[model samples]
Each structure stands twice: as structure tokens, then as C-alpha cells.
Target: MKIETQCLHEGYEPGNGEPRALPIYQSTTFTYDSTEHIGKLFDLAAEGHMYSRISNPTVDCVERKIAALEGGVGALLTSSGQAATLIAVLNICSAGDHIIASSSIYGGTFNLLDVTLRRYGIECSFIDPENGDAAIEALFRANTKLVFGETIANPAITVFDIERFAKLAHRNGVPLVVDNTFATPVLCRPFEFGADIVIHSTTKYMDGHAVQIGGVIVDSGNFCWTAERFPGLTEPDSSYHGVAYTRDFGRAAYITKARVQLMRDLGASPTAMGAFLLNLGLETLPLRMERHCANAERIAAYLSTHQKVEFVKYPKLPGNAYYERAMKYLPLGASGVIAFSIRGGRERAVRFMDALTLASNVVHVADIRTCVLHPASATHRQMTDAQLEAAGITPGLIRLSVGLEHIDDILADIAQALEQA
Candidate 1:
């Protein structure tokens, strides 16, 4: 099925008497008629739900929908965006393993890789996105298991060159893992450009109404797990009675291991309630994305013309460094996020955000309502001045998440706020 059809019909098929809408299977455990059948599930010899922590029917439906949308063999939903990132890496990496990641990602993700993961003996080297292919390839070591980056980085809004990153990763026999949270599948499908795995903070665009907090990891199923570097999947696992994930699961090796192993141990599975809400939000995603792009383009143009605006960093605008790349990867739209700097620095940036009436000042983005935030003050506050500059977050920069409101109204709100700034 095509993307539009898949969004509505791919995951769940209604039987003659079944509910048309995907129902929430809220039970924690599924009953089996025979102990032998239950044994097969626990041994990973069969495909069926044994426990909610390992898998849930309601969450499985949503995961299938997301996997279809992302052009992946399978997907796993997690309790939060952070959990998704952790699971995606942990599935393939272990202690003493290393990763090469772009520096222009979310503050939380940066902290995870730079600080938290380091404590677990998983090291990461941060590289600039503009470093080009040779520079990126230089970061990879013999123990580097994966290369990670974002499609459109949070706050920074720099569009990654997917093809370039993919080439570098594959050359080193590693898979490229991308955070598709900002771009979403509607704007760009990373798998088409050779991304082996795609991760998302469904809390943002997927749940456009801001009704749920969730995340997902979609396995493209194109990478080879038989490589000697990854023995975890190709080799036997004593925990699962000497089962090899790659030998049994085939294309689903990555996500299957993530679910039966990491999810079972860590228990970061999403609830049926969150999955239901996310599916509801997915229904209108295509339509909402169109309005969001239109509104953001208008607002970016408005801000670019304002005297108080020092600079605008939206890819849709002409002369922007990422305009051509955005046109190639996200031709339909370059997302609803826009980053701009105010002429009066941080003080005026705060005033401008506070002056907005219709666009609320919030710590959220990619919602149905227009919202604005100063990354230097709010999201990226943990970074020092040098760290902020390195991430392209200036002291006066403001991040605007344009919503599905009328473009004129959104622009008017920004114009009024700029006047006050």
C-alpha cells in the first residue's frame, strides 16, 4: 500500500464483527490454551504476545503502522523518546563499544551520549555535520558499532546530509541510525537514503495534538547482522536457550532482539493508552503536516523581514545553506520548525517570547498550537557558552514550532511579538 493508504489501513484489519478502530488490548498478559504454546513464546520460537513488557497487541498495531510508514521490516514503541534512543543503540552495542554522532542533536540526546552512556562504558565521539565525508569517516574506530544523527536537528534545525552520512557508516561496516523526530516520515523517509534504522520521539509530530508521550525505533532490515562485529545477534544467547536472533528472525533481528531482550529487562514499553492516542494522531498527520509547513514558511519570511530579527535559519528560505538539501530530501516541506536570532540578544529574545499572545511560550514543539521557545534559555540551558555556540544556538536565537493555524494569523502573532521585542 502507498503511504496514504498505509496510514489508515496497514496495521489493523477489521474482521466482519471487529471494531473498525484499533482497540486497546490493555491486558498485561495473554493466556495460552497449552503450556507448550506458552513455552514457544518465551523461547522466541513463535510469534505471539506473552507479556505486555515484551509485546502488547495494541502497541504492536501502532508499531506496525509506524514501521510501514517508515518503510521498515518491524518497529518497537518505547515509553519515552529517551528510551527509544537507548534501546536502538543498546540493541547493537555493548560495553566498550563506540559510536560516531552528530553534535547538533537535542540537548537531552547530547547529554545521553556524552555523559550517561559514557558511564555504561559506551563511548561516543561528537563530530560536526559540516565536516564532510572524509572528516566523518575519520571519527569511526574499529570498535564503532553505529553512526547516529538527526534528520533535522532539534533547536539547531540543521538538515543532515543523509546520503553522505550513510556512505560513511557503510564504508566502515556500521549502520547509520537517525533520529527522525523532527522530520517525520511525511517530510522525509531516511531509509530511502540508506539509513539502517530510524528513531522518533512520537511525542512531537506523530502525536500532533500533544496528547501522548511516546517513541519508536524502526529497523530498515537492510543491514547485515552476520558481520563478525555483531556477535550478539549472529551468535547464540544463553538467556533465550541458545537462540540466535539473526538465524531465527531474519529481517526482524534488530527489533526482535530489542523487544525480547532489552525491553524485557529494562521494561520501557509504551502503554496501550499511549499507543491508542498516538494512532489517533497519526490519522491526520498528512493533513496537519501541510498546514504546518505553510504556516512556518510564512512565519520564517515574516521574521526575516523584521528589523529586530538578526538572522533566520529555516531551510525553505532562499540562500539558506540547507535549502538545496531540504529540497531534495523534504521537497513536500521542510518541517514546521524555524530558528532565528533577535538583534537585542537574550534579553530581547525573552521579551519577544513573553509578548506573544496567540503563540504560547512553552517547552514543547510540533503541536496543533503555535509555540515558541528560546533554546539558549530553556532547552539548551545546560550547555555552556562554548557548547551553545558549537551547536549553532546563539544567545538570542529563538525556536518556533509553527502549528496548523491560519498562516496569516500565525504571522500576525509573530509581527506583534517582534514589535514588542
Candidate 2:
């Protein structure tokens, strides 16, 4: 099926007598015929729902759809984007392992890797991804188990070099994990560019209405997990009755381990209601993304010529640094995100944001309604000036998430706000 058709028809195709829409299986547990049946599920010898904590029918449908969208073997949904990142990393990396990640990423994820994950004994190196391949390789060590980057980084709007990073990770005997929240599969499928794993904050474009907060991790099932390299997947798991993941699950080892091990232990599974809402968003994703990219292009063009705007960063804009790379990977469009700096710095940025009429001021992005945020003051407030610079977040930078509204109205709102500033 085409992507648009897959959005609506991939995961759950109701039978002749079944409900048309995906039903919400809201129960916490499922029934079985006998003790032997339930025991087989517990022993990992059978396939069926056992508990909502590990899996649920409602959430599974969403997961399967996302997996199909990204061309992956399987997907696992989590409570939030943060939970998704945590489990994706811990599934492979242990306490003594290391990770090489691009410095340009969401602030919440930055904190997770730089501060929180470090305390757990996993060391991380933040590199400038624009640097040449040799420079990136310099940061890798023998114990480095994975590499990470965002498709289109938050706040900065820098487009990542997925193929470059993927090759670097593969050469070092690791898999490349990309956060594809900004440029969803409609714009770019990272798997085609060699990304081994794809992740998303489903709270963003996948849940465009902002009605749900969830995340998902999709494994491409292309990377090799050999016994000599990844003992965790290839060797026996004494915790689960000595069952080896790679031996039993084949290409699905990563996702299976992530579900039964991390999710079962952390209990970060999405709520049934949340999954239902997310599925609704996914159904309209292709339509919404078309408008999002179109509006973003027009808005970026308007901001580029604005007197009060100091700079604008949108990959679709011709003069932007990532324009060429974006054309290669995001030919359809680069989603709705745009970042610009106000002329008067942070104070003026704040003034302009407060004066907006049609646009909103919120701590969120990728919503159905246009909204703006100041990274220095809100999302990246916890980072120091040096850290902020490393992440490509300037004090005057204003991250604008353009919506499906008419381009004229959106520009008028920005124009009036600029006059107020």
C-alpha cells in the first residue's frame, strides 16, 4: 500500500462483522483457556497478550502501524519520548558502555544522555555532526555501542547527515539510532539511508492535536548483533529462563528485548486511550504534513525578509546551510519546524512571542495550531551558555512551528507582532 493508504489501513483491518475503527482494548489483563496456556505465554513459548504493562491490543495496533510506516521489523511504544530513548539505549548499552551522539538534539534528550545516563555509568561523547567523518571517528572508542542523532534537530532546525552517521556507527560495530520526530516518514524514511533504528516523540506530528503524549522505537532489523560483539542479544538471558534473543527472535531481537526487559521493568507502556487518540492522528498524517511543509516554506520566506528578524533557519529555504542535504533526504518537504532569531536578542524575542494574536505561546511544538517558543528561556533553560551553544541554541532564537492555517493569516500575525516588538 502507498504511505497514505498505510496510514489508514496498515495496522488494523476490521473483519466483515468487526468495528470499523480500531477498538480500545481497555482491560488490564486477558483471559486464557487453562493454566498451561497462561504459563506458555509467561515462559515466552507462545504469542498473546499477558498484561498491559508489557503489551496491549490498542497500543500494539499503533506500534504495528508505526513500524510499517518506517519500514522496520517491529516497534515498541512508550509513555513519552524520554522513556523511548532510555529503553532504546539501555537495551544494548550496559553500565560500562559508551555512546557517541550528535550535539544537536532536543534539550530533554541532551539532559538524559549528558546527566542522567552518565550517573548510571554510561559515558557519552557529544560531537559536532557537521565535522568530517574522521573527526567523528576520533570520538569513538572500543566500548562505544551506539550512535544517535535527530533527523531535524529541535530549536536549531539543523538537518542531520543520516547516511554519514550510519556509516560511522556501522564501521565501529554499532547501530545508528535516529530521532525522526521532526521529519516523519512522509518526508524521509531513515531506514533507506542506512539508519538501523528510528524513534519518535509521537506527541509531536504523529499526535498533531497534542491530545496524547507518547513515543515509539522502531527497529529496521538490518544491523547485525553477533555473539562476539553484542553478548546481550546473542547470549543467554538467565533472567528469562536462559532464552537468547537473537537465537529465538531473529531480526526482532532488539524490539523483543526492549519490550520484555526494559518496558516490563520500567512500566512505561502507553495508556489504551492515548493509543486510540494517536491512531486517529496517524490516519491524517500525510494530509497534515503536506500543509505543514507548504506553510513552513511560505513562513520561512516571509521571515527571511522581515526587518526585525536577525536570522532564519529552515532547511527548505535556499540560503539555509542544510538546504542541499534536505533536498536529498526531504524532497517532499522538511516538515513544519522553523527557527529564527529576533533583532533585539532575548528580550525582543520574548516581546514578539507575547504580542502574537493568532499564534500561541506554549511549551509545545508540532501542534495543529501555530505556536512559538524561546529555547534559551524555556526548553534549554537548564543548560549553561556554553552547553546551549554546543547544542546550536542561541539566546535570540525563536522556534516557530507553523500549522495548517492559511499562509496569509500566519504571516499577518507575525507582521503585527514584529511591529509591537
Candidate 3:
């Protein structure tokens, strides 16, 4: 089936004359017929769920749906997007490991890797994606376990070169992890371009209504874990009774370890109710993304020519920096988000956002309702001027997230805001 059909029918299958909607398996524990049967589950010999902390029927369905959408072998749902990143890295990396990440990632993720992960002995080197291949590759060392980058960067509105990065990682015997949150699977499936792992914060377009907070990690099951490279997977895991992941689970070693080991200890599993809502969002993703792209293209064109605007950045827009890469990766469109600079600097940008009536000046992005944010002052306020430049953030940059609203109304709001600015 195509992605649109898979979104609606991939994971859950109904019995004869049963309910069509995905059911929420609300129980915390499952019952077993005999003690010996339960023992097999505890020993990993059986695949039945015994605790909600590890898995649930409802959440499992969502995971499967996401896995199908991303063309991955398996997926794991987390309580939030942040947890997904943490688990995705920790599954392979240890205290002394290193990660090479693009500097254009979301600010929250930047802090997580540069500060929190460093606290745990995991060090990260942030490199600008625009840097030449040699400069970026030189950051990799023997300790480098993986390469991390965003598919369509958050506020920067730049697209990462997935095929290049994936090749760079594969050459160094490391997996390429792509955060495809902004450009949902409907627009671009990173796995098709050699990405080994894919991740998303379902709080974004996946849950278009902004109802639930969730995240998903999908493994393509392509990367091999040799003892010399990824000892964590090829070596015996003592916590699971000397079980080696690659030896037993084969293609699913990476994801299985994330669940049986990481999830078992950290417990960042999503609630069954959240999964139900996310499924609802996934059902309409294809339709909503079409409208989002259409509206954003019109808005970007308007912003580019406006008297009060300095420049506009939308990968789908012609003459934009990432238009070529976007055409290669996101032929459908570059999702809904766009970035533009008001003529005046920070003060003028804030003035324009405040003047808007239809579009909200909120802290959120990728929602069904149009929203705007000033990253330099709001999201990336903590960054110094030098740091902001490195992240492709200008003081006057306005991150405008186009919504599914009608083109006329959305344009009218922007026209009025530009007049005020």
C-alpha cells in the first residue's frame, strides 16, 4: 500500500464485525495461563507483553504504523520527542562515546546533546551542515558512534544533505540518525536515502491538532553491529542473562535493545490513550500536509516581496538556499514551516508578530493553526550572538509556521502584519 493508505490501515486489523477504530489497551499488566509461560516472556523466549512500561496493544499499533510509514523494520513510542532522542543515542552510545551533530537542530535538542548528554560522559561535536565534506568528516573519531542531523532543520529552514551524511556515516562504520519531525513521512522518507534510523516528535504535524505529546524512533534494520564497532549490540548484555542482540534478534537488534534494555530501565513509554490520538492524526497527515504546503508557498512568496520583509526562507520557494536539496528529498513539498526576516531587527520583528490577529504568536510550531515564533529572542535566547550565527539564526528571523487555513485568509493576515511592521 501507499503511504496514505498505510497511514490509515497499516497497524491495526479488525476481527470479523469488530470495532474499526484502534482500541486503547488501558491495562497496566497482562495475565498469563501458567507460570512457565510467564517465565518464557521474562527470559525473552516469548513475545507477549507482561507490563505496560515496556509495551501496550494500543501503543504497539502506533509504533507499527510509524514503522510502516517510515519504511523501517520496527519502532518504539516514547512519552515525548526528547525521550526518543535520549533512548535512540543511549541504545548504542556509552559514557565515552561521541556523536557528530548538525548545529542547525532544535535548540532543545542542542542543549540535550551539548549539556545533558555531556554530563553523562557522552560528548557531541556540532558542525554546520554547510561546511565542506572534509571539515565535517574530520570531526569523526574512532569513538564516534553515530551522526545526527535534522531532515528539515527547525528554525533555520535549511535542509540537510541526507545522502551525503548517510554515506559519510556508513564510511566510518556508524549509523546516520535523521530527525524527520518537521518534514513528516508524507513529504520525505529518510530511509529511502540511506538513513539508518528515523525519529519524530509526534507533538508536531503527526498530531496536527496539538492534542498529545509524543515521539517515535524507527530503525531501518540495515546497519550491522560488529563487535569492533558496536559492541553494545554484538556483545552479551548481562542484564538480559548474557543475551547478545545481533545473535538472537538479527535485524531488530538495535530497536530490541532500546526496548528491552533502555525502556525497561528508563520507562519512557507513551500512554495507550496518547497512541489512540496519534493514530487519528496519522490518518489525516497526507491531506493536511498538502494544504500546509500550498499555503506556505503562497505565504513565502508574499513575504519575499513585502516592503517590510528583508528575505524569506522556504525550501519549496525558488531561489531559496535549500531548494535544490529540497527538490531531491522533499519533492512533495518542504512541509509547512518558513522563516523570514522583517526589515528592522528584533524590535520590528516582535512588533509584526504582535500585530497579527489571525496568526498566533505562540511557542508552538507545526500545528494546524498558524503560529509564529522569534527564535533569537524566544527559543534561542540563551545563545550568544556568535552561537546564534553558527546555528543560522539571525536576530530578526521570524519563524512562521503556515497552517491549513485558507490561502486568502492566511495571506490577508500576513499582508496586514507587514503593513504594521
> Candidate 2 residues 227-260, lDDT tens each?
8768999999987898899999999999999999
TM-score of each: 0.98, 0.99, 0.99
lDDT of each: 0.91, 0.94, 0.93
For candidate 2, report its TM-score: 0.99
Best by lDDT: 2
Worst 10 residues of 2 by lDDT: 223-232
Expressed as tens digits, the lDDT of each residue in 1-421 for candidate 1 is 7676777887888899999999999899999899999999888878899999888999999999999999999999999899999999999888999999998999989989988999999999999899867777778898999999999999898999998899889989999999999889989999999999999999999998878889999999999875589999999989999989889889989889998999999999899999999999888888888888888888888888888899999999988899999999889888899999999799999999999999989889999999989998788888888878879999899999998888878888888888889
Candidate 3 minimal-lDDT segment of 10 residues: 378-387
Error of 3 at 22 (Å): 0.5
Candidate 3, 1-421: lDDT as tens digits:
9988999999999999978999989999999999999888878889989999999999998899999999999999999999999999999999999999999999889989999999999999999998998998899999999999999998998999999999999999999999999999999999999999999999999999989999999999999877997998999999888889999999999999999999999999899999999999999999999999988998988888887888898998999888999999999999899999888799999999999999999888999999999999787887778878888888789999999888899999988887887
Candidate 1 residue pairs in clash (backbone atoms < 3 Å): none
lDDT of 3 at 26: 93
Instruction: Write the candidate numbers in order of decreasing lDDT.
Output: 2, 3, 1
Off by over 4 Å in 2: none
Candidate 3 accuracy as lDDT: 0.93
Clashing pairs in model 2, backbone N/Cα/C closer than 3 A: none
Q: lDDT of candidate 2? A: 0.94
Counted clashes in each candidate structure: 0, 0, 0
